[model samples]
Target: MKKILIAHDGSKSSDKALRKAFELAGKFGSSVTVISVIPELYLTELMDIDRARILETLTGETTRTMEKIKASVKDVRTVRTMIRQGNPASEILDAAKKMKADLIITGSQGRHGAEKFLLGSVSSKLVDYAECSVLVVK
Candidate 1:
């Protein structure tokens, strides 16, 4: 069965990307793997390594997000969820590779000009570097 990877971050844009992934998965009779990349800030050496707290928070948030995304899927595609901690762009690409996903779906925050210059767009970087096809949802 086809596999599609979605990069979600609890943002509205990311939610839209999730919907798009659902659509594509339905079209292709594909299974979806929803991946949430917890920013490295939460895993820094400065913070107390409250493993239980961190895992709880991540699990709850990912569960909620997955529920919303799953509700939008009209097809009977199988689904899987994953949460990882790292840089969003690299982590997303790595997850896609590891899952053998045929497509990588992510949202573009629509930042432009100086803002985008200062903070490089994750979607842009993924589009450039991902081994599979990337669908950048607006």
Candidate 2:
């Protein structure tokens, strides 16, 4: 693939997914776009919220996560990072479309059966809506 989009949520599963993307990107000479979606509820729910502080925390965490991904990849030059605020699934798909990505890599929480039926997994919805290929890392 030429362009790859990886969605990371600062979770262990996501870290594995990021590492997998690094491996794939290296093999294919693909440019990797790493995205972290910070749920936007905090922005609206908190009264007199410090936007700068919230963004600082978000970007700082995202940067640290990106660093970990970079460390795992031998060639870091092809990797790019982005932090956004919204629903994770929609943001990921939107970012992929905007980047014209050939594939999307994401981590799964491994929820299934009754739990998945009640909670509704993001990966399942993404698989249905995404225009490009999606890889779910368990």
The count of backbone overlaps in candidate 2 is 0
lDDT against the true structure, per candidate, is: 0.77, 0.79
TM-score, structure 2 vs. true: 0.80
Error of 2 at 63 (Å): 2.6
Candidate No. with top lDDT: 2
Collision count for each candidate, in order: 0, 0
Instruction: Please provide, for model 1 over 8-121, each residue's C-alpha lDDT reduced to its tens digit, 9 standing for 90 to 100.
Output: 887777777887888778888899998887666544564465766776787788778767766766784698878787788899898888888898888776323235333237
Query: In TM-score terms, which candidate is top?
Result: 2
Off by over 4 Å in 1: 42-59, 110-120
**Residue-wise C-alpha lDDT for candidate 2, range 109-135, written one tens digit per residue:** 531324523423667777889999999
Candidate 1 has an lDDT of 0.77
Poorest 10 consecutive residues of model 2 by lDDT? 110-119
For residue 66, what is the lDDT in candidate 1? 69
Estimated TM-score per prediction? 0.77, 0.80
